[model samples]
Each structure stands twice: as C-alpha cells, then as structure tokens.
Target: MNLQGIAAVVTGGGSGLGAATARELARRGAKVAVLDINAAAAQSVAEAIGGIACVCDITSPESVEAALARASAAHGAARVLMNVAGIGGAKRVVQRDGSAAPLEQFRRIVEVNLVGSYNVLRLAAAAMAKLDPLDDGERGVIVNTASAAAFDGQVGQAAYSASKGGVAAMTLPLARDLAQHGIRVLTIAPGLFLTPLLHELPEEVQRSLGESIPFPKRLGKPEEFAALAAHIAENAALNGEVIRIDGALRLPPR
Candidate 1:
C-alpha cells in the first residue's frame, strides 16, 4: 500500500487527530474525504486539504452508507478508512447521592465509540473487498481509535473505558475476519493528549497532566498520532495489533 493516488476516508476529520490524519494522507497523494457530523467543521478541514467533505453519523447505517457513496463518487472506493469519530463521557457507577449512573450515558458512549466504529468498518470493508488488490495483494487498511483508559480507567470513567475497551478487544478478531478480503484492521490506544477538550483547560492543569507521562513529561500531539496512522497504512505486516502512543503514561486510579 503505497497510498499514492488511493482514496482515504477519515471520520471525525473536523479537528484534532482526525484533521491531522486527513492532511497527512492528502500530503501523501491520497484523495481524502473528511467525514464528520459537524458539517461546517468537516467542510473547513476538507477545504483546507483540497478534499471533499461528507457529513456522516457513524452510528447509523443509512448515514454511513450515504457518506461512503458520496466519498466513492468523489474519490473512488476508499482503500484507507480511519475510524476516529467518537465522543467521551465520565461517570461513576454510583454518584455522590448514592444513585446509580445513567444508563443512557453508557449507551451513548458505547453506541458512538464502539458500535459507530464497527458500522463504518463493515461498510468500508465491503467496498474494499470489491476492489482489485494492489501489488502486494492488499486491498485496504483500517485504523481504529481507542483510549488508554481502556487498560486502566480512573474513577468516573466507567462508560468511557468500556467503550474504548470494546474497541481494543475487537482488533484481533476483526482483523482475522477481514483477512480473507485482504483488508487489515488495527487499533491505536492513545493516552493523555492535547485534544480540543484538553486545550480548553487552564494552562497549569494542562501542565500537570503532561507531567504525569513517565518520560516525555508532556501530552501527545495530534501530528504524532497522524504520523503513526500513516505509517500503519504503509506497513503491510502491522495488522491486528493495538499500538499505544501514550508516552508511557498509565492512568492512576482517581
């Protein structure tokens, strides 16, 4: 997979790691499609990268199908699908009032992070299966986003961790399932990073969080994540694994 002149679709392409990925893939000569629920945000990133933007809701099959169709119509069948669209929430199993956590919160997180990812993946794999294999007999590659909390979630992160945990757990089986189609699947579990949400916090809070990392003593960068994703797309043998780019920061029980 040279990635040159091939089509790549990036979900959550509006900002953060997804935006960085769309730019990196485009820089490598891939025709990119920025798929996101935020129409304005997706359009902005797409325009900046000279790519098309398709408003998508990954949890809905119809929405994903339409977005994929639009992407295919614009850039041909996408061989690189990046499942990055996700939401995060933190809640304890039992609140301070001794009441149970809201089930809807957990459901929403799982629906968006885990089920949503699978929705796009299934549809993308179907399209990729129909394409002719490249020189190495590879038809496509998919990279899913997980979180460090999946391994060691802090307090109030039950919902978030479970959703990301599902992502990490499915990497191997999904890779094996798609192996017959010449499509590889992998997951990236990122630790603390400076996403838009984190950036909004006070400077001292940000600094404190960065200092938690063992070696780097800083938060991860979106570009670093995008770089890893691009490398994963090019490397033929790096399938069915969940790679972590967390700067050696394991979450402490809060």
Candidate 2:
C-alpha cells in the first residue's frame, strides 16, 4: 500500500509509540487520526501532525464506536489502523499480601489491551473492507502492539503478560481472516521502551532497567518502533507475525 493520502487511525496516539507512529504516517502523506482517552493530548498530537483528534476510551464500546465514526467522517474510512492503547500493571496472581490480585484488575488489563485492540480492529477492518483496493488489491493494514513480556513474562506480570499474550496469539488468525479483503494484520512485541510510564521511574531504577538489555544496554526509542511500523505498513508481504523490538534481552524474574 502506498499510504499516501490514505486514512489512518492510531489509538493511544497522544504519546509514546502511538504518537510517533502517527507523526510518521502523517509525514508519509497519510491522513492520520489521533485517538486517545485524553482529549487534550490527542488534540496536541493531531494539531502537530495536521491530523484529526478523536477522543476515545478503548475499553468502552460506545466510546470506540463514536470515535471511529468521527474519524471516518473526517478522513473517510481508515485504511491503516494502529492498536497501541494499553495499560501496564504488575502483580502476581497471588500477591505478597497473601491475597490474590483482584479479578477485576486482571479483567481491566484484558479489557483495555486485548478486547480494546479487537474493538478497533473490527471497526477499522469493517471500514477498510468497504474501500476500493490499492496497489495490487491491498485495501489496508492493521498493526497491533504487544510486549516482549507476552513471550517472556517475569514474576509479578501476570495481568500484563496475559493481555499481551492474547494480542500476540491473535495475530495470525486476524491476518487470515482479513486476507480475503486484502487487509493485513501484524503485531509488534516491544521490549523495554522509554514510554511515559518508564520515563517516570526514578532515575536509578530507569538506569537499572536500561542496563538490563543485553545489547545496546539502553531503553528502546519510540521512533525506532515507529520506523518498524512504517516498514511493516509499506511491506505488504509482512503479515501475521509478532516482531520483537527487544535489544536481545530476555527479562529476568522480578
């Protein structure tokens, strides 16, 4: 797909990898929509990229539907969808307090990470399928965000890991399902990146996390993740795979 002038929707586009991806897509001539729970942050990024800002809470069906409709009305149906809205929670199934992590907490992680991704995917895919094919019948591409923890989760990451794991496991099936419409699906499993959460950590803790990477020995950059997403979007053959961006580091047990 050329991406030029095509409509693209990026969830969690307010910051981190999603924001970087939105900017990159905009630079590549795509009509981007910045979707985030934070309207202010979404508006900031959208204004910077000359794109639309749609406030959306991925965990809510009504919120997602309205946001998708708004974006589609503004830029037309999305031919590129990026699922990047997620939350990170760390707790063992049985916490040190001799109590298990609340079921609601785990459900919330799954809701925002897994079900949220699916909500956007289904909505975007439906819209994309209605569009005419471009560049050898390729109508669109959907990129999902997972984490390296999905594959190598350490202690105290049950909820986070499970959420990401669901994302990784769904990639192939989604691709297969969407292939008939010339739509591709892919997932990215990033290692330790300097997202807002990670950046807020104490300086020493951040340094320790960076040093844990076997190579590079530093946090991954948001731009790096965005670059890979750009490559995946442009390369039609690359589908149904979870590409890991970890710096050769397998996380240690917490």
Best by TM-score: 1
Worst 10-residue lDDT window for candidate 2 reads 91-100
Candidate 2 wrong stretches, greater than 4 Å? none
Model 2 lDDT per residue over 6-82, tens place: 89999999999999999999999999999999999999999999999999999788998999899989998888998
The local distance difference test score of model 2 is: 0.93
How much is the lDDT of residue 14 in candidate 1? 93
Instruction: Give the Å error, residue 229, model 1.
Output: 0.3
- Return the lDDT, model 2, position 144: 98
Whole-model lDDT per candidate: 0.95, 0.93
Q: Could you give candidate 1's per-residue lDDT for residues 1-254 as a string of tens digits?
A: 89899999999999988999999999999999999999999999999999999999999999999999999999999999999999998888998999999999999999999999999999999999999999999999999999999999999988899999999999999999999999999999999889999999999999999999997999899999999999999999999999999998889998
Off by over 4 Å in 1: none
User: Model 1, 198: alpha-carbon shift in Å?
Assistant: 0.5
